[model samples]
Target chain A: MSGGLAVVGASRRVRAAHYATERPRRPVAALLARRGELAQYDGPRFGEAVFVTLQAIDLTCIRGERMIFSGLTFSVAPGRALLVRGPNGVGKTSLLRLLAGLNAPAVGQVRWAGGSLAGRVSYVGHLDAIKAALTLRENLAFWLAYRGHNRSLAAALDALGIAHLIDMPTRYLSAGQRRRAALAKLLLVDAPVWLLDEPVSSLDGRGIEVFMVALRRHLAEGGVAVLSTHQELAIDEAETLTLGRNP
Target chain B: MMRSLWALLHHDLRISLRQGNASTSVVVFFVLAVTLFPLGVGPEPQVLARIASGVVWAAALLAAMISLDRLFQADFEDGVLEQLCLAPTPLPAAVLAKALAHWLLTGLPLTLIAPVLAMALQMEGAGVVPLILGLALGTPVLSLVGAIGAGLTIGIRRGSVLLSLLVLPLFLPILIFGVGAVEAAINGLSARPHLLILGAMLLAAIVLAPLATAAALRANTE
Candidate 1:
């Protein structure tokens, strides 16, 4: 029994180490890729092409009479991800909300792709952002139409493995399934920057794996994501931005 | 932009229809409220006729109000409203589409049933058309205006009552115009002016109410 307990403890330590190592690699890889792309492009071509850049300039957010955070600053380049971490109620979500332009910052700005973040970035919060009355298929279709994606709904649903639930009302879905359905909306959209708050909250192990894969694919395609999550994510490369503390 | 609006309208209407009981509940409330007048006041045909237009319209407004609180509450709770706010199309336009859908689901049915309830109250046949017309134009305004209240009270624990308090006063003008049109038609006077005013109100709401609603939705959601 003691030996078995030792084995379990070792595994947990290994997993924690793996998790710690996994976070920073994503942004390092992004920087490397940017460097590689820059090398491939001649000087003029690199100079002329526009890349979407996200910069949170000294942001402060207040929620419910409490100051969540202040003087938070960070920037994410295209093809990168910013993993925000903090203690509960420290305002990781509020910071994302401000960065996503859902709410005004008490004092600062979140700029996107060389412009104001407004109308440019997509923000997904903890609440799956799905309508229970509509079928999963109809919900995706409506969001696609609203976002002006002009993409095929079948492909998006298939990507999320929710093609089977296409006709099912969203209220009938399990928590993990509903999160997948919500993630499917992100697939249908083509926004350059994504601000996701606790996106993996209800996802299962397999669901989290699938989400990581999807996110990697998104980054590879030059999309930027800033996600706040407490769970350790296994990504090939990522970076952590701890809020409410100087880094 | 227009396509987004149409899609929002289509999706919301389809959901309301498939939900079955929700649409019926609002209509049933309208009927029950209309039925109570005769029961309470004692069914005298002349007495019913005298108060029928106001009673039916008031009941319809109250029933419509009952359902209005749910317009954005469910979406807000389920996080769908966040996705909507994130859409490329402006949030105000989407909100207008939703308000339009709410009118179609809750307000439109109430308008359709008004004539039947009016007849039960011994309202003159000629007045029924104007009553329906007034409701058609007026209820959308009620929905659009009520959306602002709904948006404001979203996520509040006691939002339903707060929604009623905030919106009922705003609904008074619509109530006055709707009942006035029916009364004008009953008296064989031209109801066109009242109908025109109702249309104007609807147009103004279509333009202004959505902005207010979208702002409120942002505030409440944040």
Candidate 2:
């Protein structure tokens, strides 16, 4: 077990090093020039940050016969988390779907980086969407391949602690294990923002801690996340939006 | 874009293979229905030869329908359909890849087996070539057009029957031309016109069906 852990840790460091060098190097001269003044500014300039500044204004959603929610609004900026809190029927998932562009808002728009949200936004819905017949490795491979990259599959599985179940078919997985695999999907793509609906619903205590750790890393890297949860998240400085039942 | 489509196709084919039953059921249904026709109508060689093309084409059409709902239903229920929508590959192209995989599983198998079934039904030797040609061109259209009905009725319970009701009518032209090609061959006329028309419908379906299905999926999932 210690040997396996060392191998995983070693591979992760190698990949992280590869990412650092392969990525386009930022202008260090400008970084040093702006280092002193960086704290003076509240955030990136309006047009500078492409993935931040997501805003939802007066959004309304209605299902078959019920008005799930109405006149709801919020905003998510870079390095900030928007935690949506509400009761069971308060349309939390629906709102995430709206933001993810799976469903259009009945009344308003979602803006990203001061513009319309136009990129591939990652959404982890209630359903894990893993094929019950395929092994965990195959399931993750499908998403990674479909999204056109395999750079992070091993790392994602390692982070989620499902590296041991890589060869097992999803049908044999417990609910928590399956949820962990689903949460691993959030790391498979290079999505600018994550719309997570009940991201911790089926997770165990340790799974929840792992997810929060990964989410913090995502936010620290300037990605935005809109997560809905029934339990209180331990994320520091995350903004909260509470919704109530419709009239 | 091409990579994404390939990935979608690869994943769908893998699922179909692992599940093992969905595609097998389609083939089994096709074989059983084709075999049952002679029993119902009597095994007289003359009678069997007369209805061979119609029986085989009808059986293939029904077999295609039996599995059409499975194309999107599983993905939709499991939320993978939403992910597909959010994929960088435009939704229509993803739908096309899905339909292509479905045809490979259901349509291609039925086409390959049509000749054997035709032989059992005592179809003329010359008619066998046209039967295979007609089906190869026609069955894909069945999968494609069926995709529309599958998307539209995805949210409804027991939607397979509803899908048949909606799609069987659309299958009429393909069926008419598919069977007509074989009949023309048996009657000593050139089956080219019928085969060509079926090919044309396939071409048009190639362009339109995926687009329409993508729209329906967008609406229904929303």
Candidate 3:
């Protein structure tokens, strides 16, 4: 842990929601679902097998003439989460986008430690990716098919605690509700790595709790997630990375 | 696999269906634009017959162009395009799927309704068959090629005007061949060569436009 984390940790300790005991258990190793045929990107594509760990080594991101962040390094293991905390314009979102493979890093590579699961990253950014004209179920139905291997929407809906909004057109949902709908995608996707940018920004307390449960479920299932937010999520087994000018 | 492509196509169609008025209005614009010709130049059948193919083709071209501005822009704004790019499916395949959706929304309806509009403009007899065939083959190329423009202008402010400027020149080839085929049939000449060129254009657009559109989309997202 770096010095910034200590500062962040001290500040976070004052919050009443911190978990007193973090359950320590070994992370289970299993391939992401839709195995064999569909998960066709499992074998190592680089120097070594890196499927178990997600590592960002000397990563540099530049937007136009400005350097957002550079030489940023972090590695997250299976059944763990990395919380990205920083003030505004600190490249938190840029970092998550890089991890999602949405943008190529200016100088470094985001690699997995066990083996490369090339296409197994789920990214939920600021935009909800919902179709306001369509119902909630309709919006997610497409994702379910795109990811392949049909499963009941109930499980994903239950994960986000939005089962009642299933058939309603998403335009009817409030901002927080819409945010939960986007967060539900983490469950809908069977991918192991999640890159979420400010996922709880619009969520109320209950919505945040809903997100915590879903994220906990994801990490507990041997998945790794990188979440960028201004506030701490108080989830156990999650590491914090603070980006800044003087970190 | 093809499932992802199908899902993209399915999702687009569903969105269009829910926004029922948007898709239908393109066809309505096609109808109204074509109908305006007869009203403008009087009901002189000979004159209407002469310009009928050109007018209908032009209207279909404009209608396709208008609908295209929204094709990728909406998805790009909603973050669906970002999500699609992150998916396992290749970007070119996703572009192909979206182009197909665009064709189904604007091209197919325009093709189906064009003959009625052409006949309404006094374009009777042998010219009608060639017009229908030409449009069926040509309109898909319009959708495919329009995708390139849509992808290019996706993130820019007020990109539709720029989209029109970029695509109108590209659309000239399709218009010339499509209208030529119909005009040839009316003049008792073989329309085969023109329609063949249209088919070739469709095939070429199918191969090249997806790649181009995919590149544009990737660039715009960056």
Candidate 4:
């Protein structure tokens, strides 16, 4: 409760410098090199939309008898990301669901440019949601078609390094591979906002690097992302918001 | 929205095809349960013919129940239900697609096969067409009404029994009319009244069940 706001006190530039010094140069360079290959992918960008914003005010979430978190507020504009960090059972996923309009908040409001998040946000939760019996190609194609978006399935699979496994059933994939396939849905949709919960949990180091590249490109296209995680995302200029139990 | 609904329907059909066992189990149960009555009773045509319509109708009701619990549970557990709720196409429309797909896999097959099974049970010639027609108009109502039960019981563990409890009472009208139509034809009376009532129930179910199922799904997912 004491240092929650202080977590966002550090300037974006200062935090970027701190993150650079915190990581080893060799792997960082390797990650950057991999990201460069994925940078070529350009899906439908939300560029022309004048105002794309997500805001939450006095948000509160409760599970059973416990009040998980309360009095939380944050905002993410186009070209920016909001990173929610908290320990397990602190309502990180609940907050993301609230913003996604999947769950309503007990108190206060979550607004997206004065409208609901429905139809404008693409959400990826803890469960991969991929049909194990379906091939990766079919699964991605279904999601793209469901969202009414005509994005390239081949490029999305290629960017996620699962192009080789496209024709294989998702059941044969390892946990990390399955997670990467799920993450590819974000790239396949044309939504203005992305609400991801523990999106990197099962991803390997290389998979994380690919995801970072996709996320960066998404922000560059004037799309907003709000994700919750316990680990560092290492994205420069991303806003940090921490939630905890109120005393 | 139309494209999304079509996509969901196609995707659900593919999944049902891949699973394959659910529909097969329902059909197998329908055949086995229908076959049992003749063996349990004497092989006399009088007895089998007397009870043929009720036995087949009852068995069909149970068979349809076998797959009802599965209508929304698979998608709910896999997280696809949430994605479906968020889709630009209205959630009720998606529910309709899923229910229609469910009917195609479960009810439609039962309708086609019930007549064959009825003939095996020594059903008289008079009851033959009435049995097929009654089933054709009735099974879709089972699927539609069963979806509401499936949605309401999704969060309960070992909910199959509860699903039956919730939906069986609603299924009585369909079962009554289905068996009644065949009985009337066997008795040399016109079966049109009963068949028309079954059709009316199907029409009402098609219009209303999707809305109830969608609401229940929203409550469970939230």
> Which lDDT value does model 4 have at A96?
87
lDDT of 1 by residue, A1-247 (tens): 0010100000111111211221232233245356673343222222212224566777777777777677666666556687878788767887787877677888878765335556556677878877787788878888888777698888877777778888998889998899888787778887767788888998888788777877887776656788999999865445677655433
What is the TM-score of candidate 2? 0.88
Candidates ranked by lDDT: 2, 3, 4, 1
Docking class of 4: medium
On residues B35-93, what C-alpha lDDT tens digit does candidate 3 reach at each position?
88888998899999989999999999999899888998889998999988888778899
Give every collision pair in model 2. Answer: none
> On residues B153-206, what C-alpha lDDT tens digit does candidate 2 reach at each position?
998999989999999999999999999999999999999999999999999999
Query: Which residues of candidate 1, in runs, are more than 4 Å off?
Result: A1-49, A234-237, A245-247
TM-score of 4: 0.89
Chain B TM (all candidates):
0.96, 0.98, 0.98, 0.97
Distance from true position, residue A30, model 3, in Å? 20
lDDT by residue for model 2 (A174-233), tens = 989999998899888877678899989889899999999999888777667889999989
DockQ, ranked from best to worst: 3, 2, 4, 1
TM-score of every prediction relative to native? 0.86, 0.88, 0.87, 0.89
| Candidate 2 lDDT | 0.82
TM-score of decoy 3: 0.87
Model 4 chain A: ten consecutive residues of lowest lDDT: A6-15
Clashing pairs in 4: none
Interface DockQ of candidate 4 = 0.55
| Model 4: per-residue Cα lDDT over B97-171, one tens digit each | 888888888888899998898888888889989888998889889888999999999978999999999999999
